[model samples]
Target: MTLRLLPLLMLAAATSPADAVPADDAPQPAFFEALRAADLRLATIAYRLTTANAALCDQLQPQIGMPIHALTQYAPAARKAAATTFRFGATIGVEAVVAGAPADRAGVRANDSIVEIDGKAQPALPGTDAPENAGARDAAEAAIANAPVAQPLRMTLLRDGQRVPVAIKPVAGCRSRFEILLGSGLDASADGSVVQIGEKFFEGYSDAEIAVIVSHELSHNILRHRARLDAVKINRGMLAEFGRNGRLIRETEDQADLLGIYLLANAGYDPMSAPKFWREKGGDIDGGLFRSRTHGSSKARAEALVAAARDIAATPTRPIIPAVLATRNVPLR
Candidate 1:
C-alpha cells in the first residue's frame, strides 16, 4: 500500500485521486491540474525537510526529486485522461520533477514516459490498473533505491517516440519518500522510509500548515517510533490507548510533536506556525475519531509548541537536532 499513516488517529485505506472523484469522473483538464498542484506542493515541502535535516537521519535515500504516476493509479474509466494528459504507453509517467532535484537537473521533464530504469525495462502496470497502485509505484522506487546511493540512475525516456538517455545523480537526503493519498481521510503517517499525507489537507491547510503535519510524520520516522514500539511489543490493537500501551503511544506522539517543530525550524519554516496550526485547526480537524488518548489536546499541544518554539528561537545551534534522538537508543519510559 502507499503507507499513509496517522500514528494515533487510526489507519485508513489509501485511495487514489481518480478513485475518490467518481461523480466528477469526466476527463476534465482540471483534474490532473489540481492533482499535480497538490503533488508539487507536498513534494516541495518534503524536499526541504529531508535535505535540511539529513544530518539527523542514520539512513539515506538517493533523493531523486520526482513523483511518478502509474497508469494503474487511475480507475479503468479514468485511464484515458491520464494517458492523454501524461502521454502514457506501457510505462509510467513523470508526474512532477522538483526544481533543482536530480531528475530535473538531468533534463527530465513532466509527462515524460519512463521506459527503463538503469537499463532495466519497465513494463506497464499489470492487469487493467487498480486504484491501489502504490505497490507498483513503489517497485519503481525500489529499482532506484537498490542502486548505490553515491551513483546516478541511468534512465531511458520515450520522448517523441525516441528513446532518450539521461542520468539522475541523486543527492543524499533523509531516507524518506513523500506520497499523497488522493481523496483520503484526515490522516498523515510516516513509515521508516516513506511519508504519506492526505491531499484533503490542501483544502483545509496552507502550505505552511501542511508542512506542520508533514513534519510531524517525518519526526515519527526520524525518531524510529514504529520499530521501537514493535521491539517493545506494546499492544497496538483497539485497546492501545489503555495502560502502558497508551502511555508509550502518547510518548511517541509527544516526542513527534516537539521534534516536528524543531524540524520545521530547521527547514527554514516559521516554527511558530506549528503552534498556530494546532491552535486554530487542531480543535476543528482533530475532533471525532481523529482525537485520541495517544495524542495531546489541541490547546495543550499548541501551548507546548509555543514553548518549544521559544526554546528553538533562543538556541543558536544550526539544524538544532533533537536531544531526545540520543535517548532513542535507550528503552522508552
Candidate 2:
C-alpha cells in the first residue's frame, strides 16, 4: 500500500469492550473464537517485543513492522467447487503468518492456498516444529529478525484454477504493526499511526472487516487530522481551548471516517463493509460501549459513513496534475 503523507498527533483515549457482536442470524465460526484468543496473546508478545527491541525499534524509527496474523477461509479442494459455490472448512481459525509483513506490499488475496515456502512443502515440516503451528508465537518474529533485509523470498500459491509462483521483498520504514486486543471497543490516534480493536470485534469480523479498521485509521493520518486539530487549537486561542477541543475532535473524527471510506475503496477493499460491520455489531448505541469510547456512537458512525460513501460513489474523479515540461533555452514565441 502507498503511504499517505500526513503529520502526526498525540491523541489519547481509553478503551473497553462493549458493542462487538455478530448478527444473531449469521452462523458463528468456531475458528474465529480461537483466532481472537490468539490475537490477544500476540498483542502481549508485541508489547514485549517493543520493549525488548527498543533499540532496534528506534533504529527502525518511523517504520512499524508487525506479524501478519494468519486467517483461514474455506476454498474448494477441487476445481469444480472453485466455479460457483464454497463452504467453510472444519476447524477454521487463524495463526500468525510467521514472517509475513504487510509493509512488504505483497498482496495476499483472501482464500489463496499456501502450498510451499522456501521450496519445502508445508505438510513436510514436523507437526510441532512448523512456524505456523509452533507453540511459541515469536517463532515467526525470530525468523524475520534474523533474515537479511530486502532479500527475495518465494511463495507458491494456488489462485483460481492455476498454480502460481511469486517473489516478495520486504521494504524498510513502514510503521504501524497491529494486533487485535480482547474486549469490544474502537480506538484510533491522530496520526493514523495505530489502531486497537477489541477481541470480541476481531472474532466477529472477517479479514476484510479488519482491513476496514486499518484503512480508516490510515485515513486519519492521510487527512492530517492531528495537524488540523493543532491549527484549530491555535485559532481558538488559549481561553477557548478546552471548550472548543471536544467539538474539534468530533469533527475531525467524522472527517477521518469520510476519508477512510475513500481510502479503503481505492485500495480495493469493500467500501460498504465498514457500515455493515458496525450495523451488525450494534450501531453506535451509548457511544458504542460494547465497542470503544473513542469511536462515535454506533448508529451515528454507521449512518454517517454510509452517507459519506454514497457521496464518494457519486463524485467524479479529479484529473491528475502533471509535472512541468522541460524547455529549450533559446526559443521565444
Tell me the RMSD of model 1 versus the true structure.
4.5
Report the number of the highest-TM-score candidate: 1
List TM-scores for all candidates, in order: 0.87, 0.43
Q: Please report, as a residue range, the 10-residue window in candidate 2 with the lowest summed lDDT.
A: 3-12
- Which pairs of residues collide in model 1? 5-188, 5-189
Best by lDDT: 1
**TM-score for model 1?**
0.87
Q: Candidate 2: lDDT of 302?
A: 85
lDDT of each: 0.76, 0.40
What digit string (tens of lDDT, one per residue) describes model 2 on residues 1-333?
111100001001112223222322222233333443445343333332332223222223222123322211111121122112212111111122323344234654433444544454432212222222222223333333434445755556555645567565644332334544333344333344444554444444566666555555554554455555565453333342244555555555665566556655544455687787667754433344332333477677889879766765675552111110011111211
lDDT per residue (tens digit) for residues 1-333 in model 1? 112212111111233444334443444556566677778888888888888887888878777778787766665566676677777765577888788888889999888888899888887634654453445666777887677779988999877777789999877777777887544667777767678887678765899999999999998898888888888898878888898999998898899899899889988999999999988888766754245688888989999999999999998877898786775566776
- lDDT, residue 273, model 1: 100
